[model samples]
Target: MYPEPVWTEWEDPDDFAEAFQLHVERHGENVYRLHKAITAQGFKIDPQTLYTWKRGDKEPRSATGLRVLKAIERRYRLPDGYFSSKLAHSGRMITGGGLEKLSVVERRRLAWHLPDNFDLLPRAKRAEILAWVRTVIISGATDYRRYHANAVLHRFSFRFSEGASPLPFPKPRPLEERLADEGAPEVGRPVQTERAPIILDTEARDLRLFKTATLTTGGRGRNGVWNDETANQKMEHLGLLFGALAACPEGEVRGYGAPVRCMTFAVLLFPAVWDWYLRWREIKRGFFTRWESEMLTVVAGLTRQGTGWLRQSPHLAGYLRPIAGLITPADIVAATEDWDGVCETIHRHAIVRAKEVDRVARVHRDPFEPILTILEADSPLGEYRKISEEVRRRRPDRRRFPVAAAEATRGYLMIRMGLHLGLRQKNLRQLLVVPRGRSPTPERQLEALKRGELRWSDRDGGWEVFVPAVAFKNAGSTFFRKSPLRLILPDLSGLYDEIDVWLRLDRKALLKTQPDPRTFFVKTVKNKSNSGAYEQHKFYEAWRSIIQRYGIYNPYTGRGAIEGLLPHGPHNVRDVLATHVLKQTGSYEQASYAIQDTPDTIAEHYGRFLPQDKAALVAQVLNQVWGS
Candidate 1:
């Protein structure tokens, strides 16, 4: 029997009347009521007007207008694209309007009107605004219009404007011209001024503001002051003031704010200011010199002695009195000729703490070795070897072995796989063996191994475990890619197959303890008491224990365990693979392609052909070529 078609009609006709009628019938009475409601809400325009919107006759008014249209769609229970034409028109209008001209101040006002939270705009948009503001400032666009634009940018945060409203000029000027003008004084003669040590009452307000601003901006912290861009700006202003004062006659330096003097200030102030300016120049090219004026004011205040300063100054003399004891012949040579005796005296007195400075420099100079050692020795591979050796020596029975041996092996596997794959602990825990469709569980461990598909093809050859995006730290939609260390090993395919067999055998019993079919690593009785089932912390502890057991010392660290391995983590395996490939091929380009590493990184970390192993590697290669 033929079924009768449902017939429905829209009361208020529009360009999409036929489609709307069809949609109303398909969606039922609830949708029809929604359509009527939307039409009643002043959206019941003529069909031709709707058609104009659909056919690009007009544009959408604003983002709000688009939202209104979307609301209508929701009310009528329409498909996503049902009112897409109207929404898109609205979008075009808004996009065009966004480019409309506005003065710098107006722009700032607009930006202020935007949501207060940081995340309101996309990162790219924020970056664009930041870049634009920099460009405008660099271009010396100091007019009211430009400043208004700057104000708009400043509305995003004080960090953007550095707490000052954008400079307002009546018109744009060249950077050079602006600098020249700024350098010139407004009056030919100096204003009435007096030079005196800083009085607590007079300088108090400005000093307070300075301290508050510095603290609020994250300048002062436990680690010492952070020399950020704003600090650099201040330093430049100081430099300018210093230069100006130096040029001025000694007596003419009259109107200085305060006279404060401390030896530490005398030693550090100029250098610190210079360094800040240098760093600022490195980060941003051609920031003009307002720093000199500001720095002069600070210096003036430092010349005054507070009660706190008076108390602290005497302590400094005794503290470094033994610096002379530490001075060496090399230190004498390094010291300037004029200051050599002074330097030696400082070193002998123990006043300078030179060794501490040297130690800090050394650590900074070579950070890679220590950091890698710490991470790797505490890794899974190191742990595994430890446990395996323990079990082999003990030779415990099968029941006890499962409890001790299997637990150890599992920890090792997790660490090994995690480092090799660079999977975060949570994602590593969530890893599952993708099953073949229409297949039931098999009793055979080897069959289960064959069924589990969790591997990826390597660049060189063979397969390694493939870590999907869900398992990655970033939680991206795309899979996190990595190549296996086996690719660089001799008989790569054979080694991979051996690892596969090893995993299958080890996981066989553990598989039976799974709480759900989707869970990959099943908890055996040994690991049942472990928190989170597969916690990374447990893996770390197990690794540390294994390192102590195996006594594997890194040659670099003179310490036992995998911590000696350079560039730790799953990535280190890749580094090792890349290093070996470079050695084997003796071709930088080929090695780079094989391991997918940059030439620079490879050269820096992996390219060094160890002196001890060089002869043996070459001999082996030569023998292979000669059929020895």
Candidate 2:
């Protein structure tokens, strides 16, 4: 669904007859040939009408004229929207795999509507689809045998039938088959998975020792005027050293004194040191993000510089601060052993950021749009009756309902919460229907879902969700911040009512085999633990998988809505909610509270209100004061 190019010079002029005559003068000889090509693309306008318009006897009026212009633009490889006025629009683009250079509108469309499913498709099949589209453009047709040529696949129903659809996943092996992930190449030495794993290597184990931790300057900031309270920290910066040792390519861990290892260790400390002092150096966070931490882990593994950091070039200052001096060569020498916390932290950060960076790097893309549109009122996000009928056609119920129905319901409910509330991944994962009393065990939660008698906090009134302070990213940090404030789950009546049905039907059915499903979300396929929480990584992967398999991505951009036809990262929910609230309310105070941030902070980053909004706000207040 590529956007129709907007002709900047000719927006709503008196008449397009002048523009039509000019086009005819330039393409006098080729006009008839272009007419034939346009006809091939399903434009049914008579050639006589085209000549009449070009000769100034009649101005072009039908949509077919627009389609002919598009065909001519492609056939001649003309500058995008070159001969366009406000009138000409084909509603399609150059239809081959190799498109003509993108127009201004096309660039915006590509940035916004790059299909999430496009990259997920297999290389050969992707070529086939692209080639099919190219053929359709040449022949000016859409239907071909059993398949249809759509710029973006219209529905994911074609997904199951695609037979060769390439999902971006290693085929899932049953948990038993992956006991050791035997065939996968070791990234560094193999890591552990047991809760509280022990890193067998000795140098890394030092992080757990009390002596390895240092008592850094405590109480308040170095200057009391800067921060309200300065709490001293007892930190084990040795884990920072462990980051490099464990991150090295498999054989390099033991060769700590090697020049290459020395350089890698120093390089690792540079970002960690720069992280503490330079506040806004990182994106979207007051402090260093897990992305920085993960970047260090990758630098250690991939780069093989030999003590180049010791050369004293001013360039080194870009990464290293004076604090890096405290981490000496001996510290690197002593860091041969690996610890569980160090490895797990590095690995988890790597996994999370890998997905995060891809979307973040593409500044304005929203890969979640198609799915979100389908979730609108009366679509899958609500009663899901349309989706139910679709599924029921293909799936025979094995139990009370088909497995497809259960998965679809659960997925729809999860996405709806994200769009409506802007909840974070962890916040969604830690949700509890058994309210704020003594927390419910897995057995109790399971029983509650099945019986439909959830332990509501009648004290706080029913359906109150208590988000623990520990869930905040800043929870354990002693950085500049305000008092911890607990957030109330936004009260949306019909929304919570949907949760009731999900728990009773979808969730219960998914976990029916598990003797104990500890968390609200359980694994679709059996893995390690009997029934455990859906980890953040798994939650995002599932969301993406479901969206690509079931929805559509819009080709048009500039909808001026927050969520559109493409899928986005789970973290973007907070952004979508904050920006949307600001656009609607025009108050930073309202946006801050909605996103759980300070007013200044919300204005600095999250909100995207227009300048006109401020002018409107002033008028609104004056009207309120004087009774408009």
Number of the predicted model whose lDDT against the real structure is largest? 2
- Work out the TM-score per prediction: 0.28, 0.41
- Summed backbone clashes in each candidate are 49, 19
Residue range 80-173, candidate 1, lDDT tens digits: 5455431221112222223346565544423321222212356776556545433332222234334344433321100112232222212323
1-628, model 2: which lDDT tens digit per residue?
Answer: 1223333233333234555554444444445765676777776888888787665555433334544665665654455555443232112223222334556565333322222233335767546655543332122222321132331132110001111112222232343332222222224442211111121112122211211223212111111111101110111122323332333234322212111112222333333333322232233222344445444434332222221111211122122112222343333223222222233333444445445544443323222233334333222233222232322222222242335456756665665655554555766665545533545334444333321213445565555433433344434333214333333344464555555666666666666666634455554645455454576668877664443333322222111222233433466556556655665577787776665566786676655555775676567778897874
Candidate 2 residue 437 Cα shift, in angstroms, is: 12
Model 2 misplaced stretches (Cα beyond 4 Å): 1-201, 208-401, 419-421, 435-455, 459-461, 476-493, 527-530, 549-564, 610-628
lDDT of 2: 0.40
* Residue ranges of candidate 1 with Cα displaced over 4 Å: 1-396, 411-431, 435-464, 468-538, 551-575, 587-596, 606-608, 611-628
Per-model CA lDDT versus the true structure: 0.35, 0.40
lDDT at 622 for candidate 2?
A: 81
lDDT of 1 at 245: 26
